[model samples]
Target chain A: MRTVEFETIAEAVADAAIDAGRVLPEDVLAALAAAHDRETAPIAKEILERVIENARIAREHQMPLCQDCGLAVCFVRIGSEVRVAGGGIADAINEGVRRGYERGYLRKSVLNDPLKRMNTDDNTPAVIHFDIVGADELTIGYMAKGGGCENMSRTAMLTPADGRDGVIEFVVKTVRKAGGNPCPPIIVGVGIGGTLERAALLAKRTLLRRLDEHNDDADLAALEAEILDRVNALGIGPQGMGGNTTALGVHVEAFPCHIASLPVAVNIECHSHRTRRIVL
Target chain B: MTDTHILTTPLTDEHVAELRAGDRVLLSGVVYTARDAAHRRMIECLERDEPLPIPIDGQVIYYVGPTPAPPGRVIGSAGPTTSYRMDPYTQRLLALGLKATIGKGRRSQQVVEAMKRHRAVYLAAIGGAAALIASSIKECKVLAYEDLGPEAVRRLVVENFPAIVANDIYGGSVYEETTECSD
Candidate 1:
């Protein structure tokens, strides 16, 4: 059994957060550039141009690509064979989040409560989701979810009679209703099946996948492509300015569910879509 | 475009009038920072007829809650938050003579109506581009609600701050006109 010091986790979390804060992940940037090329709406095209310019300015000046630095969320994949020593893993992760948010000049957006809405000041107590994946080598994925797109997310439980076409229609309508509110062209993550909460979790988790990749299931992958095509055909455009490139991509994830229910959740990601992963 | 207007911040009607939908601007002057919390407080203060924590007349309020600045820096990653969240309090500010606002996202119809009624303009800074905006800020000082943390009211001095006119005083909103499906 390998024992890792808590400080090691803390150090890794802090450094990773800082690095993620400074750079727009390569996949996100590439997706935006490609969107700019494919976008046909004049106004949407203009919005894309400004988005590209914003990235250039951010990188050149070493500034955050967008002002909403986002709430710190960490997904930890722990190895069952590895044990942590010196302190609690969760505490270490929080400490690292505090240190990195403060040091990197990323905004602390976490509020202590949903209704009262008090800023936590330090971006502490990161929203951490952990999974025990294997016997060796832990993987950590950190994502900063901004409020704009997060606010527009939706979940629904359709009867099994609704089928795949029903799911596609619901997703397209959700995107259309969201319009410019989520900061299009948006990346959509669709989670189907499982229990209601797990379906939402799967939707949020699917957001962590690479921008260009599709579902491993061939049928699901085709469904994802079809949904993407329909969403873009909405002509919501970049920044909802009106364009052919309404969606950057669609990703789907599925699991078996009770025969009575077909649950679906759509989590929209704004253009920035900041995320980073590290294996240690 | 070289014949640009160089206006001092806390923008006035004349400054706002000079701008049109889609016009590029390089604004320099003193702007104040506030977010959802501060906006709520400001509205509440007005309800009680209490003295405002910060003056609003002829002012350009930036919707931002910046990251803590590093040593010797004026501000950090100070970009606009989505503007619609503050929609409820906007008319109250406009009634008090607010001349301009800077943030991303489309404003509600009520906010747009208030902008026209009060002769105010809304500007859109690039969203998700905080670091780029910070480079334009030359000076920053806490003016009020320092305890509100990053949401505190800050008096900022900016130079060549880039923004596009999103809403003008003529009851026009670029977001509505530009969004193809809006019609």
Candidate 2:
């Protein structure tokens, strides 16, 4: 059995949070470069160029990639054979979030209540998802999800008869409705075949995957490609100025479902794509 | 590289009138900030028939809640929030002689109608271009609602701030241009 101290987890989370805020993920940067190369519209190209430049400045100066700083969504995969020694895993994570936001000068955007509208100040109570796995290790997947792209994400419960084409249509329509609001060229995460909440979670979790990677299933990969093509065709280019480039990538995650349902969800991520992984 | 145009603010109605959707401008000079909470309070003051804390005649309002400034910096990374979230409150503000609004994304239909009627324009700063945008801000300070932290209404002096006209007084919308081009 392996033992991990609470301070170790807290330290890792704090560092990852700061690093993620300052640096654009390499995969996302490469994806943006690819989009810039193919974009024909001069305005869209300029927008993409500025986006790349923004990332560079953010990295070099240690400034946040965006002012939103985002809500901390932490995915914890804890090894069944490992034991946490110092404190609760969640407490350590919240502590880390506090230190990260405070120490790193990141914005504390989280509010205490939806209706009451009070700022939490430290960005605590991170939305943590835990899973028990076989390896003797702890891996944390972190994303500082901005509100604009998040607000644009959508979900629909399609009948079983709706199937593949229905999914594509819904995804395209959602992107069209989203327009420039999510900050194109956005990454699209699709989740199919699950219960309502599961579908949403699958869509969000799929965003943590590398943008350049594809699903193992050939059919799902093909679906991702098809959806990507259709979404780009919407002509809602970067900042919706009109061009061939709209989405940077489309990632689809799927699961088996009951006979009556075809639940679908689209999680939109802005070009910032601030995600980091910590292993301890 | 596409050409970048420059404009100075507290923008005049004539300046707002000339802007077309998709035209890029680098704005300089005085502007004010207000987000959801500050905007709500401002509107409530109007409803109570009290004077606005800051008179906004022929001025621009940026939709933003900036991160805290680190030691020595005049301000922090300040980027525009999504505009539609403020659409409900915008028309009323425009009626107060506001000439322009700067943010990202499409404005509501009602906001567009108000812009055309009031001779105002909507400009978009790149959504994620906070650090780059912060470079143009020469100064910032809270004018009211200090308790809101980042959401406090701030008076800012910016120099060569970059943006593109997304909505214009001529009833043109950049959002409309994007969808129409695909057809």
Candidate 3:
């Protein structure tokens, strides 16, 4: 087994956290620029310009893009042939998150307990998802997910009869109900076919996909396009100021489920989409 | 289309009266900062019939919890947070003579009604434009609730802070106007 030092992983996670906080992914930036170009409403156009400018300032000055630096969420893929030395992977990740939040000047948003509501201070204990893969290499994907759009995410177990049209309708209605709350123009990640929790996870995972990329499956791609069209037609616009560009992208991920279940989840992401991936 | 207005704090009835939904505003002067935790505490103080930590009359309350400032900066990337969460306490605060609020997203119908009743307004800063927003804040000082960390109440002096009047005293709502036109 090829062993990766624990400190190496910790350092990488720390850098990823800091970088993700400060930088807007290029795909998101391009999508915002395109949205600016396509926008017809003068107010919407102005908002998009500010969004772009904000991203620029965040990068140039090494500043967290938004006041809400968000909870540190890391998705890890570890190969069976690889081993970590020194400490547990989760501990290492938590350490990294702690350092990153402190050193990067990112907001410490995590609370130790949901009900008690006490700040953890260091933004420790990142939400980590681990997967075992066949390759010898390790891959880590990180996202700084703010609370506003996350609060708008939804999951539903639909009857088989609901089908494609029902899914589309549910998504559109959710975005409409969310209105300006999720901070449009938003990116929607739709998870279909998995069990309830799995569907939610899949929906969030789909958000890590680049905005410019489409699902490889033609049918899924078409579904994404349809959802995007209908969501935009809602005219939630930029910051719900009302315009043609409510959503910048819609991505759909599906998995096989029990015959009795047709679960769907929609994960909403705001314009300040911050994410990064690292391979080790 | 409406003209952008340059407004300073301690807003008068005349200042609040002229604002309509969708008007751009360049706001300067002092505003107090509060978020979910701070608002909860403020309401608790009110429940006990204690005075608020900061005076509310004719002042703007920005719904934000800014990140800790880096060295040499007055404040870190400070921007508006979602406003609806504070809806429960908003009308109460407005009833106390709060002139206006600054935040992102739409407020509830009750809050809008309270705005109409109290002759206050709701303004929205660009939701995710934190760094850009910080440039407008010339100074920031924690006024109370220092234990709340980022959620601590702060006194901020801003210059030309950009916002749009999302809701007005006359029941005008930029959100509704945009939606109606889009449809």
Candidate 4:
């Protein structure tokens, strides 16, 4: 097995965190530009312009695009052929989060208690999700999820009879209910199948897919298109001020589940969908 | 562009009603900072008829929990947290003469009614724009709940603190008037 040093992982995580903080991913940028082109409302177009400008200024100045630096959430795909050296993986990740939040001047938003909430200062204790893969390469994906969009997410365990139409309706309803709160034009990530928790995870993972790409399943692709069209019809516009463009894209990822259960999860991503991937 | 309203530290119902949605102003004097935890405490104080740790009458509260400033700076990137989380306690606070609130997002129906009845206004600072928010704060000093960390209540001296009126005292809400995207 190839042994990778803890410091190496730490360094990569720290660097990736900083880079993710400064740069809004290219896909998000592209989506905003396209939305700007299609948006009819002059005010909505102006808002989109400012969003694009915010991303540009954030990149050029090496400052976070939004003040809510976001919770440090990492998805690591560990290789079976590789072993970690030095310290515990959790500690390394925490250290990396500390360094990244400090170095990048990202806001430290983690709080200790939900009820009697207290800020943790360093933005440590990243919500790390790991999967062991057969490949020799390790992949790390980071998404700086803001509170607005994160709060708007929803999940439901639908009856088997609900099926495809049910999933589409639920997702559209979630987005419609979210309205201007999630900061549109937004990205809707849908996860169908698996158990409840697995469905939620799949929904979040679907966010990592590129905006322009469609699901491999033709039926799913058609559903996504229909939902996207209907969502734009809402006229929530930019910042909910009124416009034709509500959602920038809709992405769906599915897995087979038990015969009785049809679980669905919707993860809403705001305009600043900050994410980046690294291989080590 | 600048209005000189001699409102008390924590503003009053009369003062709140004077403002409109989308008006920008420089807020001076005293205001407190509170988020989820502090909000609950303040409401609890009201529930028990106990005096609040700080005065709420005729004051404008900014709903923010800012990061600790780096050395010389008074405060770090200070932007508005989501406002709806405090919706539960809003009517109580407004009824007690808490004049205006500054935050982002829509409030509940009860809170809107409270604003109309008690004559309060909800102002919105741009969400997620922390650095820009920080630059507006001229001075800050912690007054209560030191252990709450960033969620502590503090006195802020702001010059031209930028905010747009969200819900006015007359029961006008940008959220109500603003068209929402459909799906």
Candidate 5:
């Protein structure tokens, strides 16, 4: 059996959190450049420039990109033959999040209770999702999900009769309603088929794809491009101030669903998308 | 925008009048910070017959919940939050003579109407650009509601703080023109 130390995982998580918070991924930067170049409105172009300049300032100063440093979401894929050799997996992950937020000077946005509303102070209890695969590698993926964009996300259950056109229409309408609230030139992550929860999870997982990458499934890739086109045509543009660049990308992930159900979820992400992965 | 306007805060109606939708402005002077939690508290104080800790008349309110300042910093990343959450309280503040408010996103119809009636404007700071926004802030201090932590009301002195006039008194909104939707 392959053995991995809990503290080793913790250390990697800590470093990844801090680095991800400060730096927008390179693919995301390239997408911003393209959006700036492709934009048709003077105001949209100026907004894109400010966004690019903001990234430079955040990196140069070693500061978090936004005040909402985001809730730490860790996706862990463990090998069937591998075993964690130290503390509990959840504890290790939370400890890493606490250390990272503390050391990096990122904001502690988590509260002890959603209703009672007391401060957690250390930004603990990161949301962790685990998947098991038949391999000897343990891969940890981290995403910082800001509430502004998360609040703009939505899910809908459609009849199987609604078909592909329904999926495209719903995503476009949802983004149209979101307007400037989610901070446009946004990335739209779409999950199709599956049950309600799985569709939601898959939508979020699709967001992990690099901005330039297409879906492995050819048909799904075509759907992604079509949805991207329609959403941009809505003219929500950068910051919804109007332009031709409403969405940077649309990522769709689909699986088989029940005959009667077609579940769809749209997880919107802002331009400051930050994600990182470490393999052990 | 073909031109960038430089403005000072505690803004006058005349200053606000010069602004139009899509105009880029560099603001130098003081702005007060308030979010959902603090706005509720200020409204409560008004109901209880208490004077506001900060003035609203001829003032610009920035909707932000800033991170804590690091060892040698005046403020942490202090960018605008989504503004709609504060919409319920906005009309009240506008009625009390708030000159302008800065945030990101579309606003309620009532808010647009109030801005038109009050001769105020709605400005948008780049939403995700917190570190850059903090760089423009020269000073910051908690004015009230420190218990709210990041949501506390704070007074900030900033220079050349960049923003776009998203909604103007002339009934023009950058979002409306962009989205082509009436809401």
Candidate 6:
């Protein structure tokens, strides 16, 4: 079994968090560029240009892309043959997040409790998801998810009879209702099937996929295209001022479910999509 | 597209009167910052007949909770937050003579109606353009509610801060006017 030091993990997580805050993923940048080229509305085009320029400024100056630097989220795949030495994985990740937010001058946006509403100050503990896989390598995927878009996420359990059309309609309706609050020119992540919580997790996991990547399943890829068309038809545009470019892309992930359950979840991601991945 | 207007605060009635939906505005001068927590406190103070920390008359409130400044910088990545969360408290502030609010996204219909009744306007900054927006902010000082951390009320001096008039006193709405796709 290979052993990874907790300090090593912490340092990596810290660097990843800082990088994710300042740099828009290259694929997301490409998608925004394509959207700018196609957007006809004058306001929409201008807004897209600003978004692009904002990304560049953040990177050049090594500053957080947005003021709401977002809550830390990590998805980890631990190899069955690997072990973390010095401390638990969760604690290490949280330590990294605290240092990253402080050292990078990123905003500490987390509240200690939902109801009491006191600032956590250091932006910990991160929301971490873990999976055990049959390998010798450990991989961590990180995202700095803003509150505005997370607030717009939704989950629904549809009957098997509802099928493909139902999924498309529900997603389109959700985007329509969201308008500009979640920051349009949004990326839509959809999770189909699985249990309620799993579907939600799956939806968020789909967001980590690069915008240009297609689903391995042919039918799923086709469904993603259809949903993309319907969502852009929304006219929510950039910041909902209205235009044809409401969404930069739509990504969908699916898994098998019990005969009676067909759960679906939608996780909306804003244009400032910041994500990073590391493997050891 | 309309001509871009260069506006300075505290805004006058004439300034509010001249704006229309879709007009690009470059706002300068002083503006106050407040977000969810601070708004709640302001409304609570109003209900108690207590004075607000910042004067409302003819002032603009920017709904932003900026990151703490790194050394040598006045601020860090200041940008507009989602505005709909403030809808519940906005009308009351408008009633108190708040001239305008700068934020991102759509305001509630009630808030828009309140803007019309109060002869005010709603301006939208490009969301997520925080780093660029920070360049426009010349200075920032905490005005009140320091315990609220980022949500505290702060005074900002800005120059050529870019925004678009999303709602106007005449009931014009940029969201409605620019929509071209079918339902």
Worst-scoring 10-residue span by lDDT in model 2 chain A: A239-248
Among all candidates shown, the one with the greatest lDDT: 6
| Tens-digit lDDT track of model 2 for B1-183 | 333567887777778877887788899988999999999999999999988767688888999888888888888788889989899899998998898889998888889999999899999999898988888999998999988888889999999889988888888877886552231
Deviation in angstroms for B96 in model 3? 0.7
Tens-digit lDDT string for candidate 6 (A1-280):
9999999999999999899999998898999999999999898899999999999999999989999999888899998999999999999999999999999999999999999999989999899999999978799989999999999888999999999888898888788878888888999999999899999999999999999998999999999999999988878899998889889889999999989988999999999998999786
Per-model chain B TM-scores are 0.92, 0.93, 0.96, 0.87, 0.96, 0.95
Model 4 global lDDT (CA atoms, 0 to 1): 0.78
Task: Name the docking class for model 4.
Answer: acceptable
Candidate 4 ranges with C-alpha deviation above 4 Å: A40-50, A113-118, B1-18, B22-31, B47-53, B177-183
Which is superior by lDDT, 4 or 6?
6
Candidate 2 vs 4: which has more lDDT: 2
Candidate 1 lDDT by residue in tens digits, B119-183: 99988876666776788899999888887888888989899988778788986666663342321
RMSD of 6: 1.7
Q: Give the higher-lDDT candidate: 3 or 5.
A: 3
lDDT of each: 0.81, 0.89, 0.92, 0.78, 0.89, 0.92
Which portions of model 1 show Cα errors greater than 4 Å?
A: A40-46, A56-62, B1-8, B177-183
Pairs clashing in candidate 6?
none
Looking at candidate 6, what is the lDDT of residue B57?
A: 91
Instruction: Give me the displacement of residue A71 in model 3, in angstroms.
Output: 0.6
| Arranged by lDDT, best first | 6, 3, 5, 2, 1, 4
lDDT of 2 by residue, A1-280 (tens): 9999999989889998999998998999998898899988888888889989999988988888899999999989999998898899999999999999998899889989999988889988799999999979799999999989999999999998888999998899899988989888899999998799889999999999998899999999999999999989888999877888889899999999989999999999999899998889
Better of 4 and 5 by lDDT: 5
Regions of model 3 farther than 4 Å from truth:
B177-183
Q: Is the docking of candidate 5 incorrect, acceptable, medium or high quality?
A: medium
- TM for every model, in the order presented, reads 0.92, 0.97, 0.98, 0.88, 0.96, 0.98
Q: Is candidate 5 or candidate 6 better by DockQ?
A: 5
Q: Which residue pairs of candidate 1 clash?
A: A63-B131, A64-B131, A65-B128, A65-B129, A66-B128, A66-B129, A184-A239, B9-B29
Query: Could you tell me the TM-score of chain A in candidate 2?
Result: 0.98
Using TM-score as the yardstick, the better of models 2 and 4 is: 2
Segments in model 2 whose C-alpha atoms lie over 4 Å from true places: B1-5, B179-183
